[model samples]
Target: MKIGDTYFSADVETDGPIPGPYSMLSFALVYAGQYDGQTFEKPSKYDQIFYREIKPISENYEVEALNINQLDRERLQREGASPKDAMNDAWDWVMSLAGETKPVLAAYPVSFDWTWLYWYFIAFSDKGSPFGYSRCFDIKTAVSIKANLPFSSAGRSKLPDWLQPEREHTHFAVDDAIEQAEIFAKIAEWKA
Candidate 1:
């Protein structure tokens, strides 16, 4: 039996602007909730999460980008999980959570986070991307269209106070993912 789409709110902290040249320092996926076409069942607690910090794939990294997330590259280099292990574990986690439901990735912007995640999943995991190639929901775009605001005005800072998540926007991937999940839930239930 096919169930509703299971949304996973994702966040990635990277050492550079894009994947390939830079490395994804860490990433997190929070089981946002499930939508059964008629209603979105928002989870009471954003506790089910998959998080991983992986070793850099390349030596190239920007100091400024690294400073944003404050992930110690040297420490990660020594202790972080290998990309293959992390990605595979991520795939398993997503599948386990989703079960019969179609897994859908949700993110604030989606583009940046999806890009890194897709690249890493494809390059490392044998099972490949759990969300496939394009099953993603962009909270920014949803706010823009749903709220009848210009795309430029849909940034988190510019969004209506009601739509804002109570959680702080810490640079940590898991924290950010939970925050984004809350925002997505609000947007999904919003009438406008």
Candidate 2:
């Protein structure tokens, strides 16, 4: 097995743009693959994953954002994992998977997803972020660099057919994580 940073494709559905005021309703991370300096090893499938739903910290939330993911706030309040517990579980899972290699957070457009996750990890876990700070890869940036296109033109619709994932981009975190993992893997192969 190649040893280096393992690319974990992460997706998050939030109650709003930020974390403290809003909340991360749910999130997922799929083992996309890894690349040594010489070559890439793609996961057989993006099935190795972790997911968790969190209880909302604040009642304040955007109704439109809540509707997007269809997460029941009341149900989450009653049954969802506490934010600290959820973040601890995620940190433990990621560390277990990483054993030897470092785990790097990968996302389509990393800004939004990374912001929420990093905030949650720090706010909830005394152990600190499993990813630390700045260990993230943006797939959109990868595509932009690989295709030699302007960053603004790196949207999904602008992706080359070879780099597109077959799965749909449903708002559900796990589903989208898997979908984004496929894209990440393809990008790695091409870039290799």
Candidate 3:
């Protein structure tokens, strides 16, 4: 039987502005819900999730970026999972969660998270990215269009009270992913 699309809300913490040059320090993917064309079934509990901290791929990094997420690169280099292992595990988890359905990566803006994830998956996973090269859902853009606001004004801080997520916006990758997933579900259910 054909199943619905499974949306995984994603968030990545990087050591710098981009991948390769810097590194994806950590990341998270939380299963939000499923949509079978007509109806969206939001997860009863946001417990289905995957998270990993990855060793730096390169020595290059920015101090400013590190200050934001506060991930110690040196410590990660010694204790974190290797890129190859992390990506492979993430790919496997995503596939298992999706089962027969198509998996879509959802994020607040999508561009930044997608960039890092796509690059890492291509560079590390033998099977490549689970979302292919493109399947992504941008919650920011969705809200902008749905609420008839300009893209610049779509940031979380400016969202209507009803559109704001109930979860706290901690910078931690998993926390942010869960928060964004909540926003995505609310957007999906909103009437406009």
Q: By the lDDT metric, which is better: model 1 or model 3?
A: 1
> RMSD of each candidate?
0.9, 1.5, 0.9
lDDT of 1 by residue, 13-97 (tens): 9999989999999999999999989889999999999999999999999999888999999999999999999999999999999
Off by over 4 Å in 3: none
Model 1 poorest 10 in a row by lDDT: 1-10
Q: Write the per-residue lDDT of candidate 3 for residues 1-192, one digit (tens) a residue.
A: 547899999999998998989899999999999999889989988999899999999999999999999899999989999999999999999999899999999999999999999999999999999999899999999999999999999998998998888888888999999999999999988876
TM-scores of the models, in the order given: 0.98, 0.96, 0.98
lDDT of each: 0.95, 0.89, 0.94
Clashes of 1: 0
Q: Order of all candidates by lDDT, from best down to worst?
A: 1, 3, 2
Give every collision pair in model 1. Answer: none
**Model 2, position 93: C-alpha lDDT score:** 88
User: Candidate 1, 2: how far from true, in Å?
Assistant: 5.7
Clashing pairs in 2: none
Model 2 scores worst on lDDT over the 10 consecutive residues at: 183-192
The positional error of residue 30 in candidate 2, measured at the CA in angstroms, is 0.6
- Candidates sorted by TM-score, best first: 1, 3, 2
